[model samples]
Target: MEQQATAPRPRSIAPVDVEQAEAALIEHYPRLVRLGYLVLPPALGRNRRVLTAHALVQRALPRNRVGGAELTVPAPRGTDGVPSEPGYTYVRQRVLRAALDAGRPRGRWQPPRPGQLPPLLPRVWGLRLFPRSGGADELALDQALSSLSGPGRAAYVLRGLELSDDRDVRRVLSAAGVEDPGAALAEADGVRTPAGSRDTPLLESVEFDPCSLQARPTDLMRRRQHTRAALTAAAAAVVCATLLGLPGDGWGRDGAAAPPYAQNAAAEAALDPAKLTQATSSAWKSADRPGFATWPARGDRTGDRELLRRALAAWARPGRAVRVTATPGTPVGPASGPPQLLFAGEVDAAAVVLLHDGVRVVRYAEAKSGEAGAAALDFARTDAADADTSTAIVVGRTDGNVRYLTAPWVTGTAVRDLLAPAAAGQPLHRDAEGVTDATPSPAPSGGCRAWPALRLGSRLVTDLGELVPARLTVGAPGSPRDVAGAQALAGWAHSACHLQSVRSQGVRSVNAWQFATQPLPGGAGSAAWLCTRAETWRGAGSRVQAQFQVPGSRPGAPGAVVARAEDSAACGARDPHVLAGVLWKSKAGAWYALAAGSDDVASITATGGVRGSARGALLAVPARAGAHAELSALTTAGKKLTTLR
Candidate 1:
């Protein structure tokens, strides 16, 4: 009797019909699209990922209807608030399968399936569409996801988006053609969710949502050039066909080419090397403006017509093999007319050319060995660049060293380690072209050991991993002066490491202002609060940080960044005021709410759990550990100011 006993037969999952699948997909369109986006590879870029996500979800409807045969899948368990529905499960599986397929690397012999290729039905032109940027946590999560494999990403998305358990996730991945579902799940475990984010999952952030998107225009001028080129090719083909039909060998003995059609005179002049503008050696002395426009062209190969031609042609239409890059907000369009030639000469193994077109600085470089198709072109926005900001331009960079071309006004060039204030500036020699000797650049990979800054006469400029170095200044926002004095240098030495946050941000200048100093409770010593603001060439995306430097800290130790914000008007020339507060633990092991404000603040106050008001801009109030508080201040001008976020 015991041997005859057996387990009951398992129940079969109901098939999802096309009508039901369509209803479920339309109802949960955004959620499905987001799932697809998270599962897809980040290398496809945001624009393609957005369109592809929508395409995958739209095509998830069942195509087979014979005998009502379609997707047969178990309904969701509804364990994590997701509704349990057979239709939703069917369509979700379809979207997930396509997304995983899209992320796979294409093989040489294997032909791409419909889902593997870029979606053709939802094509976008002239505009790059992507999801809005999220906070630091979301950005970190996205970067972590990018390092995972296709199946691993799928597993993570399934767990986050569907809230499915391991058993359910394995079943789903196996059905989606994943060979090793367990391995994929194990790989996904490597990504650690951000702390204190259980209430708001990073997976649901706007950074991963394709339904809500931001649109930016692509390279409009380049698109127009491509259109013109296509039309020109078509016209040339017609002319050749007509000539071929002509009698008498279809050509004359002169062997002359056909005349050009629909050519732009200004464009032609822009591409002509001879038309490049060259400033006089003494132009800066008498010029109305002291910027790139007044910089003299100084280089040995300035007159090299062949080199100049190659640079100009590459600027106009760079080949596919050429590496072209541009800073944020920098335009890479062809020069409108002869651009100002800043420099053209051999720097190391490559011949380099620098050109300025009023709003942008274009750098073109090519191999000195006359390599036919190898070249590089770079663009950087230099709008509103004045004498202070245009003190130097990076002439050459190789390995970890960088060479700068100083302005004629710069009487002397010196190299100084920004992290070492007491260290004297080392003299940097310049050649006849005003190019300084190669010095160690601030390597991000090297950590905060040392930061090399270029001291051009009385001004200080540091490379922010851009074509143009960002000038360093110190003082009040309304009237900032170049960093020069020992006190200013000492102040900068403590804040130099913070500049890494603003690297490659198209920053024109960074100003550090010592806002307020407060004595710690129980005589733990005084703490200085400084605010550093990075102003960009685009006049947007500016970064502001409020730093707290403890008294008697190590000489080379950087200040602790207490608060930071992006694209904020506070602590800028327009505002010239900032207020921030942080919880501090003194040496006595007592907690205090410390608040500081700029000089303009008439009074400082802390509310909420910790309450205090001080006549001056600095306030310290004893409070329990982990207590929260709100900070506000009244300016001398009778205006209320909140803490800069």
Candidate 2:
């Protein structure tokens, strides 16, 4: 009787509502594009790769007849009853299958006939490292994909591009209809598919080889994660290692004290009390520059001596067995005056070189980056500034393999209160003995007032310098012993390569070895050092400290600066040995920079050139209500002085 009213209840619906499905797919397009970018290499131009992948995704998904802006049909769901993470499994599976199909050996696995398959297989492109932008070769990627069965190509793409984690990657392979998806995925990880091989002769004119990326996908994954950490740690280690050695030859194995020389004492005295003088002022001042009272003497080799004692007390923890040794064969000449300092660090290999005369100290990486060579695996730089009282230059290195160098163009106290101890004593060979007998002391007797310059080394400095033993004010993480000895060896091995370079004079026999000594009782870690005889030339004429650096790193980043001093006396009132400086990234990200006295800012490009700018005039005295004489004098004299401020 109610047939009219009950008429709607009798109809059974089809499994998938096509009209609603089409609507859902329209909504899914945006997700498809994002997923494609994530799955593909960044080097692939954004437009082409993503658009193609989107089109492919649209065709693959179940669609509805309603095709305008709105999706008319409901999207499909897995048996698990959830919409998957847009690209998580399905797309990953497809990409892998696609890559495999393109690269699989023709005879190893049979392929389905073209008539029975998806229309776009021939249009699919296997991903390539360097894809051709526009030309006949442009279709090469698609051609490669067509050679594989769908499932094989998907496996190759996902694994090679670093798209997903292991378990998920497996699941994706299975869903793509791959035979023994597990085996194929694993094989995809290991063997080079023909289409993917970079060097393999091409099936067509296209040069891309999908197999070139073949590797245990997990192996590639592990490498990617470890690189960042490894590079940072190695760089820091090198800086610590090299700077530690700059002070002196470390203590000898048995432990004996060395003697301090007049040159060492003079270097120490020069830094004690510098006055902030004008750039045109004479090198020396009437004030007796008070040397750091706690600074170690040249002969304090055993690390347990009085020099280290004072140094540790004043500067914080001092490493044991610190020593300074002049390169035995270096041609010793009359003192040019004060020695100019230089610091260098490399990223390809974890190594830092501190040069005063010869390579006063050197440290190397045992592993990581690439392979240790002159190539810019890491970036470096150097800088300098006037600290009101004195002038100093600092060189810094970073992970990207870049270096920066900065210094004062004119002689003023450019650097002062260098934390580096005087070159003294024989090197200590073990970590257990890196401390001095000196009693604990206070903060720097006086603030270090000087002009500062810095050098940027190639690559990031990775050593957690915070972990080394240093003055608490210096921010070392732990006592030096916490990371010294063989444990430090691990640091060396974790980098891309060790730093090696021919000295400017080109002494073929130069060999510098750097390692950490035993931790001292006071919790200082010392760096051991050794150098052979060689010839060195300091600057005399225009004072060009030619520093070679690998840029490629953000500016103001840390690096190592190597300085040569033709006349040590020229560096009077400044620390002539070694020092470290902070590197900040520049706005454009190319050059490293530093500012001196508010108005002057100096910038050093990655390629190594110096340029400076000044903001305002200070020479003219401001007129005051009561000070007529000084104002009148400045007004008259200031008019005569004309130069860009």
Candidate 3:
């Protein structure tokens, strides 16, 4: 009996068959792919990594009914509610093993595995696919992961994605062929998760999910050029052979044209400068439509055919040295036909040409000295241009100064500091060509010190570092009026600095509405709640910001941004109603939850961490510092609303 007690029989682990493994892989495809994505090296780039992660997971199924080899499957702990089946465990290990192998460097003599190379099964052409970009925390986490070793990344992914304990991670890593699981675990300990993400691991964020992706075209212009070149080369050979057989001295007349054998009349017509459309001086007043089409060419060089040809050629086929940029949603394609000439002249040291293609305003600039390879082309979408919005266009920008080409209807132009409402507007002189003298532009990176805007006669416009300056208006959403009166200007001064958030967003107009004026709890003077909504030219991606400004703050000081939202109808023409709350500290050092809504709100309520209710649109409740609360409101129309974020 003593001899029989020498050793207890080791538990026999069941094998995972092909059918079982395939079923598990199919059921948990997204989870497995995410795990593989996190473990794969970031140097492969987002697009390739997404493809490779999927490839690894798809190849994880067992080869035959009888399992090829035993896998270390930990007992179910109910951490993620996924059953700890042998099949799932086997496929998970295979995916982990492949991901780690993909990160390893290829040896000169060793044959490369399928996982080590770019995946061929799922391939995309003429497009780049990647996960949507995350915030700074996600970027930091991705960089930290990139610095870890293959095994270390595996350890971290197991702990984060698989919700595994230290023992399970070590076992999984060892099973995945990690030479030193303990060292890998120790290495992973050095990489901490992003701050404020303890409850939700960064591994589960959309940035790391390969299944959900954002797609962008890859070098479309270059692809088109390549295709055109290939077709031209084939056509040129045929033309050359035919000319050599039939004609005498075929290259004599068509010397330069011999190489460019593909001659399309429409393409040539688009590049011709003489074909440019020009409107009459007073066409806008009598025309059926009021837009760029009725805008007469005004610059001094409008009749210069050579300069116009250069601009058209550059727009059609921008060289490698040309710097091209387009606003968010603007098209940068070659001209479809002759575009309307808005302006053409030398402003500063560059020859500038502005063209309108019905939908976008295109600006092309070249060095006046005819510098061989230096040029710039910019495009801004302007689908519908009216008298107010078409008041000004940015003609030139150099150093930290910008010049504007005022509309013919603009009787006078003056520069006003948006942050200084009390200061009188300074007169800005314009030349005979309607180009205004250069003014100090807003320092985009220099913080919110000052915002210089153009006060054109009675209308106000501000440059957002875009081709067209955004029109500034006051009053309610649907029927906004021109920024006028001392009260409107002062209100704008408090919230002008917040405009930086909407820069380069193709904003057509920015309306400031003082939705509510709430008195302080401890008589700390009245505070104003403003809703600034920026409407873009593309009719989408509108930005709304709710700001709270306490009375007697520093002059030109930006208000505290309580809440912000993008592409939301709230605080806009359609909805025109918004609710937001903030934890404010009174002058007496007492903390209180202050909330305000539009006039249309019937009642407002605060819940969680802090609780209060008010029948009107404003609420003030005593609360501790840093209290968290959820805000909901009922409008007069009985519509329920949550606080904007």
Question: What are the lDDT figures for the candidates, one per model?
Answer: 0.80, 0.26, 0.80
> Per-residue lDDT for 1-645 in model 2, tens only?
654211111111233344444454455544443334333322122333344444445554433442222221112223232244332333333433343343333553566421212235324233222222221122223323323334444555545443344444455545443456555455455433333336532322221322121111122423444465466657655654674577665422111112233345544432221210122122233224411111111211222223222222111111222221122233322222232222233322133222231212211111222222221111111111112111111122221111222122212111111111111111111111111111111111122211011111111111111111111011011212212233222232221111122212212111111211212122223212111111122222211111112233222222232223222221111211111111223334433332111112121111123233323311111122222121000111222111111
Candidate 1: tens digits of C-alpha lDDT, residues 1-645: 466422222233687677888888989899999999898876566677789899999988877762125453444687887757778888888888899988776787888854566789688878777776554356446656866899999989888878567777877887677878888888999887754468888898886889998776765655765666566666656675686688774322111122223468886788677899988999999977799999999898899877787777677766543567788888887888999999999886578999999999988887754555346788999987888899998878753457888898999987777777776676676888898766656754434767878889889999988999999999988899988778798889899988888888899999999988888888888888999999999999999999999888776689989888889988888998999888999877888899999888899888899999998788888888989898889999998998878
Task: Give the poorly placed runs of model 3, Cα more than 4 Å off.
Answer: 1-262
Least accurate 10 contiguous residues by lDDT in model 3: 251-260
Winner on TM-score between 1 and 2 is: 1
TM-score for each of the candidates: 0.60, 0.23, 0.60
- Ranked by lDDT from best down, the candidates are 3, 1, 2
The TM-score, computed over Cα atoms with residue i paired to residue i, of candidate 3 is 0.60
lDDT score, candidate 1, position 85: 78
Collision pairs in model 1: none
